[model samples]
Target chain A: MPYRYLEDIATADVAFEAWGKDLGELFAEAADATTNVMVEGLASIKRKETIDIELRNPELDILLYNFLNELVYLKDARRLLLRAYDITVEKEWPDFRLKAKVSGEAIDHARHRLKADVKAVTLHRLSVRETPEGWKATVVLDI
Target chain B: MRAQLAVPESIKKISDTVWEIPASYKPGMLVPARIYATEKLLKEMDAGVFDQVTNVACLPGIVNYALCMPDGHWGYGFPIGGVAAFDAERGVISPGGIGFDINCGMRLVLTNLTYEEVKPRLHELVDSLFYRIPTGVGSTGFIKLSFSEFEELVEQGSRWCLKKGLAWPEDLELTEERGCFAGADASKVSRKAVERGFDQVGTLGSGNHYCEIQVARPENIFDGNTARAFGFTVPDQVAVMFHCGSRGFGHQVATDYLQVFLDVMERKYGIKTLDRELACAPFNSPEGQAYFAAMKCAVNMAFANRQVILHRIREVFSNVFKKSPEALGMSMAYDVTHNTAKLEDHTINGRRTRLLVHRKGSTRAFGPGMEGIPERYRETGQPVIIGGSMETGSYLMAGLSTGAGAFYSTAHGSGRTMSRHQAKRTYRGEKLKRDMEARGIYVRSDTWGGLAEEAGAAYKNIDEVVEATELAGLSKRVVRLLPIGNIKG
Candidate 1:
């Protein structure tokens, strides 16, 4: 049961489910689906660039916010459209590191378009769970 | 989904215009619950807000409505959009209503330079503005206030800025209560609030706070030919708008007073509440007076904060355009608060009693020719600013006299429709930035996670929300603004 967007408000709970041989593929699929809800052409990104991210949250919900926020930061500072290619999420000794490959073309008025500018990841109705088949997380975004 | 609410036994819908939760509803309620939202929006409200609002209704010595505004949401305890008035004689004050950011509000600036004149320099202007204004979480400020000066600021609000040469005296004319709430006793504020506030004047705190550039609509312009017609011209002219509030000092004050209220709610007055987060002391009571004094301190601090930001903006324009701020036409349009409680004379039960009106997550929209309004624009009405998220456009409105029944208030921002968690899970930061850039909204932020949390989709539609406010006769739209650039903290 890979994660999927809910019919709720932009901030409403979204369901995600995916199973991969390793953590990298699982995260990549999750990232692809997440960005897909925002715009078209996630697969169009050439995976030309890679961003290194490290985030630690007492809860998985906060971790998700950090992950998404990093993507937002890169977009604003550098006018680049990014599609997550590969992702690695690890938890050990109370520290977590998430590394991923991302790629997008430089922003051009003729190309990319804007939809929503999210403010902050909220704590409302955030959950991450493991299933027999794979993993599922339900999160509400603060659009 | 429609709003799923857990209505406490204490609450009852008296009519379409009113909702009440009795004291017996939750055992600690000093007064009944009151809400002022339309049927449609009310039906869309979050259930947690109902619990929080009822919890506030049960506070000690609250008189009149333990009110909830149209955009109410589940907050710390009193609900983000909740408002309640305590009788000056026996009412109580709680920090929960004022929120962590005291007087967190919106300010609009109209320039002599129309949008067309500034359009060519839009990129330079946004970059300069972002650099000039300090922003982000735990951000510091350029102006630092001394202990005695801080006291004056707390007591005098924006007037303090005028005295310090940071503002135009005429600017105060367009501010609420002339930018000051009287009876602010600086001595009552906690040392922690004072310490935190002393150096953070003129800084923008993080989380949904922003400075934006917008263009006004043609028909809704109030100035007509007066030159202040929202400064919109064609598509290039830019009007500056920002939303901020008292910074860390305000948060500390709210924290301090909330603790005070909780401690004495039962012991000093035998008042109890279902939620300790809704703790309060009577307005006329010693505890209430103390809280009110501290709240005013935060209010004044916010005024000074905005004043300083204005100065910084002027400096930025001068540097970027190579002209004086005056030459750049960087003058303030108006400043108004969304989260605050004040004592005003309003006709209640057909009698004009000085009732305390709490406008949490609501703006004060006084009607045309109100005595309190400044003389220059008395015919038009008080300026009302409604800020939308970065991706969406914000609006400037004018108050209508018809709003007197609701204590002259209107909605603040588009209410949150999506939670932050859902946003991060659904949207990637880089992708969102690309989309925003394509729309011509240049954004500068510190954290990607923070940016994702504030995606514009998280909020209700601004146009719909503003229309609802008008339909409810809360405020009349004057000008609509589309964002060209933004700086978020």
Candidate 2:
């Protein structure tokens, strides 16, 4: 997994940090981290459905925030647990945009072993920066 | 202590139960971060509270001080239990401060039956409650409203419930905002929020959301007059308490606005904050007003949600006991929200100003004589309902005059001392359930994994937390109710 849990951020909320050689892997792994928080049985979710996510912002950090929050919205609004993979971030300067292809299936209460429901992706201490090695994002999920 | 949470050494002690982090602690802070906690409680607090509270103090036009109740814990933008009043003219409004669970609150309903009367039937009642009230993740509610009806509910709040015969007129009087928040704009609500809310009117969302049956202990009643006024008549009198919010409707509303504020804060309004989660626009600005209008819809949705649940509880009790709800004395005591931002007039420097008070993980503890409080409670003040862990007991208290000093807010609950991940690692849900059963407390929940995370040990002792609130003079303890039955989401 390219993403790992951050143990010390909060006592009630969950936190994680994801890194990749490029934005694609970074955002995808972040989604995985988010998905894993609510369901440990991520492997059981067959990708029978695909979702196209598009978001726009002038800032790289805000764009990352929106991308993660969109997944949370989908889970609550559409009853879908989406995982992003085909992710691309265009940092065309004064404007940053994200277009991603994500897949997951409808929530199955019997099949999907549920954990805490991630209410939303919060921007508190949310970090999206380009490191010398790659790109890194820090996320805190409100449960 | 973990390095991630360390209260800075510069915090100055103001009293035995008060501490202040002066603005000098941070360069741009407009006021100090005031904390109501004993030295020991402060030591047990996560150091992250220091940063979050100070960050709140830095918000533009924040008045007085950014205060945290004794039950303060680390949260996204505001330290949970955070209370801040912003000038309506220049201060900013951040959804982060109100929390994603908009108007998440506590509703206490008093019943004529005693603990002994309900103890034997506890298991059956819990089973019925669990079956009747949809809960857990993706728990679809039974009430399905058309979009137009849903829009009406959003705008009318508990009043809609009254019309549906789900609530009494008296019920509205006991609720904050009289069960209906003004300024809700259905047009401003997103369709996604409406869709999520459609079937979620009577649901209990997962993670700390629950419906518990409790009995007031006569010995625990500190103020008999106040307790009677709030409907607690005798020891062992049963009361139903549920902690829930606007469900996914509020979640989407908050999610949508957080993005809007992030874009508008810097680009259009020139506002700056330490964290993106603290994104906000000036309270009077177009974007801010729009968010507030939409937020009111969610607030009303939550009020209606609880009212509908209250109706379900009444039905369950009436069926189980073979009595009408009124004959069972199943009238509501009071309802108060922990997460909300509302426009209210408070005396500032002896002058009343309409300030937008944002309370997160904190309950409004309005003192006596506040017109916003229910008429029956106006003389005694608002009832501040604080929930405890399943094994531990909950509390009922009255907002004291001293509460006005802290923006009339008090601790919401026993703050978490350990993370859910930490508790799940050490606790087993089935084993905990057995343990609770051994102690005479019945536990019914959707999943063991979820139950494991809510282990009582994961939180600070509620007795100590409630004591802190009382001793801090923020609120006065009235009675303590021990849990006999619980239905968790």
The positional error of residue B211 in candidate 2, measured at the CA in angstroms, is 0.9
Q: Give the per-residue lDDT digits (tens) of candidate 1, residues A5-119.
A: 5644333323344344455555565555555434445555555666665666555544554566455445433535567665776776576556776666554434433333322
Clashes of 1: 54
Query: lDDT per residue, candidate 1, B390-485, as tens digits?
Result: 888888887888876567877788878777667777787778877998887777765565577678888877877777677767787767788877
TM-score of chain A of each: 0.72, 0.95
Cand 2, B chain, TM: 0.98
What C-alpha lDDT, on a 0 to 100 scale, does residue B298 get in candidate 2? 93
User: Clashing residue pairs in candidate 2, if any?
Assistant: B5-B47, B6-B47
What's the true lDDT of residue B103 in model 1?
95
Chain B superposition TM-score per model: 0.91, 0.98
What value does the interface RMSD of model 2 take? 1.4
